[model samples]
Target: MKNFKSEIENPIISKDILDLENKIALYYEGKIDEARFRSLRLARGIYGQRQFGVQMIRIKLPYGKVSSEQLHRIAEVSDTYSRGRLHITTRQDIQIHHVSLEKTPELWAELEQDEITLREACGNTVRNVTASETAGIDIKEPFDVSPYAQAVFEFFLRNPICQEMGRKFKISFSGTDEDTALSFINDLGFIAKLNKGEKGFKILIGGGLGSQPRPANVMCEFISVDKIIPLIEAVLRVFDRYGERTKRSRARLKFLVQQIGLVAFVKLVKEEHKALSNQTYKIDTAKFDKEIILPEIKIPSVKIKNMETYNLWKETNVIPQKQQGLFAIGIKIHLGNFYTDKARLLAHLIKKYAANELRLSLRQNILIRHVKEELLPFFYVELKKLGFAETGYNSLVDITACPGTDTCNLGIASSTGITKELEKVLTNEYPHYKNNKDITIKISGCMNACGQHAMAHIGFQGMAIKSGNLVAPALQVLLGGGIIGNGKGRFSDKVIKIPSKRGPEALRYLLNDFETKKEDKETFLKYYDRKQEHYFYKLLKPLADTSNLQQKDFMDWGSNEQYINTVGIGECAGVVIDLVATLLFESEEKIEQAKASLQLNQFSDSAYYAYTSMVNTAKALLLTKEEKTNTQAIIITEFEKLFSDKIKLETPFSEFVYQIKKNKPSKEFTTKYVQDAAFFYKKVTTYRTKTRSNGNNQQA
Candidate 1:
């Protein structure tokens, strides 16, 4: 493969691409451990798909903003390196699957030319920073959150504090109290606010969705915008130090905050304040507040063949921007899957007639902003040709679904197949509900909730049900979950489990009941809450009966073969390995990174890198004794217990490690911390060598 390292303009990004190339070579040559390589690749946005060899590349777009040129670049890269398909994720990322792992470096280089990145899009690092797709143009917003979201994305892209954490961290920004960005379900969520003429944010912390969904607790009702980034840095530092590690199921920031009560978590976060690089980082919104330049094109006259259909589309798919005389056109992408051929055409259309930009919505749709009202018909005509003019934008027919069994390794059933069936049912049987934005439907292939099923008005989680000796794919129906605005949200309760093939019928029953019994202005969630879980369970109980199962029930949706309940090891967060050599090797890498950051005069980053190095070295040694090295806190304490006598330090081991939070990350302190880390690493390495020399070591 040709190396594109020299073509990358940013030296840091160039080094990143070169490092990936080197790592790939090392992995192929069996120099790096498989688990270690998996972690490395995943952090770079190279994910292993359900298909064995090909990888999925997640392109991280901050706040979902994409320029026409960037879109063209992405489409070109897709055509060149992938199968010419793009899948927009719920986190506002673009994913291209069936890519060769070896070609990823080059593909990433191509993307970098357009100022797009794949860094930290996955793995045990900060994922994509998402926000409201209508951020800059929301009428109800106190201010646009695009600049804040972009600032956060830039600050943490390759920051040492969050890299190699126990699990992935997620952050989001909402432009208004409407909470369209779903702030209640992220690690750190910010809602734009204005208090007494000062710009601020309402903060939510430690929210997540999986088998067990937890709503975020209010960290504060309001905090100045300048303090938000610092607060988030402190939170990440706390999570990295104290969050669970060994058990993948309980490694999220939510689990950490839940384990130690929210009060204690907040205290720990406050303790990290001094260690942060900036006490107050102000986000500049001047660039984002600039006047949007719309294309100056003569309005094309297009006669509407179906005036009623165009009107329905206008009602459902068009959003009036806060800016006068301009609009935002919503394209309801089916299953979030669109091809590069159409992508190119859309790119051209937006560049020629619109604002040369679009936002990939959180619900896996496209929002073309800054369109003139006169251009609506032209957009409709163009989008319809590409099958992007589906009605029900953010409505009942606009279903949110994960890639499920199609490409995801963790998927237990076909979420897309069932989504298609339900859409058919909704469009054909209940067309009146097309514009019903009150109800939300989401599907996840498994309990991991990548589809965010737990937070939907109507949710389905894929599972397996047994009938005698045979197993069939099933959907666990959940109800009564939705955003309640202003950082408050609800989680759905599992009502019943039905065969996967009957998913459409399950939707039909729920929607029918909701349609008939709901009060005049009652939302789906309100109706669900009134009816309650038991009532829905009773209503859908007939589909749960397995005694009268047909052969088709044995098969999963969109599959010809009978269901076998096959599930591979999930890399939603990369696998955690305890290989001692790999750990030591990683420790050395961290030390090198610390030194590099120190040279660059990044004091806090250097200190954190050194801290990670020390912890990693201690964990490596502790693993030799077969000790439980779960969290960094545990690693620190256990190291003192087991190796305090063996390797004497100037101060107690805990005190030495705990200096990170005790003092500010000054240049002098960072230099000393790096030295201390190096000394500790040397002592541990010498101790291990002596133990091995005397034949006292149990393992290498």
Candidate 2:
């Protein structure tokens, strides 16, 4: 025992964090709306929303591993600095709602003290890095991904070039193909892989979920962690320079990945990787003994022969542990919620008894790893006392839902309330489903799809209705959704809408239908797929169509708000281009203009000039510099430029300047272009900014 030993320590937040916070606070409060405020807000994790009076703040949690102390701090921050609640986003990041414009700087400083940050969490930058919690510990895992995830997080924490990219970039790492880390659906994903004796990762780039969803592309076969930064830098730089700068919506890396094949994209990334600094993957594992060790556990003695209850838990609740004889137990939390006191207690209990090792699952649940099998029964009793002893993990009652109407401003319906009721109804009646396999029932409060209801087995979406005097909210039924293998899955389709009060009944009908319609142990999804949606909806006749309101899909018909006649006395007296007659009437003027531009040449169609002019006018009015534009909409501009001379019956519009690539002399243009111009023209002009300027007037 010569003195050849080592020591370990936890890293603290950088001192510059405080100084940076001060500078940001001065800028935000003083209305110093210069380059500095813009720069810092991107760094401080502040995101401006389209809603009139609110903002969303994203908090970065490295490796999906968070401290109980940090959780409590966040809870406090929500109660004091925000809307008294914290939102767990799909990206494994926490979002704070309705934060006052002034308190942000203080909030960032507090997070800095806890070694957490908002820097580059949002705003066209490298978002929070995600990794599998079982990175090194799960035997199913090929290798530990924590080091690689940590490396990427630190490498791009504030890298200047990659800081403000085309849009936010999401990076994820998975140790196994089981892929709880959602590597397949990220902007950059690395699923662990090995060949021969060399251990490495499978790289994917460009996946995202929004209005436009696309899966990522695999760039590397198996690149060592040593080149992770350079590889990422190369990919992002290509996205920055070549991505569509004109359109905000289509500017995601996926669009570029589509335009340039994955092979070409990886080639560019490999090129950029050569220019960046070469970093080492060599870490001294001995340096972080505390970080690597499991949380301390309070070993209790429950010496009994029958371990049936414990066995059930081991079968359902526990996940495989990479270390022999150790397992990770999943403590299912309904709707990813725990009160302040409950959270605080769990933190201490975990640190003292569960080896200080806790991880959150994608299903909005918690997991405690490395608990000894013999001490498990005693641990189960403790967990029981904490009111968390529900041994059924991934059972019916273990449903996940977004906060919905309880908190979110964008919520269309009540998710937490519905999830709670749905969970109770299923657990009370559908106990047979656990053996059937893990059925995920997710609920989204609104069309924004926060719950990712798109990926659940039986998804419920919240929607509102305008009935005779009152407008009530209700849940819409979406069946047949879940993970097939890895992250490749399809979204559930909305078969019908059910009133909130009748949700339990509707769900029961679905479960009952599953039993009767299924053939010899066929899974629920298979039956639903074969039976088809109409057959299923036919079962619940009126319940399926709860509103019974003639649903013509607002987009297909038209905006109800546009029907309001405000062109006469509105504050902003812009023309309301609603009816087809309005467009057809414009033909009279365009024909007259066409007579002048044609120079004695008789035009075949007079309505063509009129239609083109109307569309160009509408396009000009809709497109403006005060707002951001997407490249997908550039065709409208191109149309305007192509029909300029023919569209001489136009008022001076600034939007026409950039539209249409070249105003060449031509005569072979068809009326289809004119019709397209008119079709898109009406949709663009009818759009209105429904907002209130006074911040205090808005409600969540």
TM-scores of all candidate predictions against the true structure: 0.98, 0.69
Which one wins on lDDT?
1
- Model 2, residue 182: C-alpha shift (Å): 2.2
lDDT agreement of model 2 with the native:
0.60
Q: In candidate 1, which residue ranges exceed 4 Å CA deviation? A: 696-700
Q: Pairs clashing in candidate 1?
A: none
Off by over 4 Å in 2: 1-30, 33-43, 47-57, 68-87, 95-101, 259-264, 270-274, 279-298, 302-311, 434-436, 465-476, 497-502, 537-541, 546-700
Instruction: Tell how far residue 393 is off in model 1, in angstroms.
Output: 0.7
Model 1 quality (TM-score): 0.98
- Expressed as tens digits, the lDDT of each residue in 187-283 for candidate 2 is 8888888778677777777776544556666666678756666677656656654566445566678888888788887666555443333333443
The root-mean-square deviation over C-alpha atoms between each candidate and the true structure, in angstroms, is 1.5, 16.0
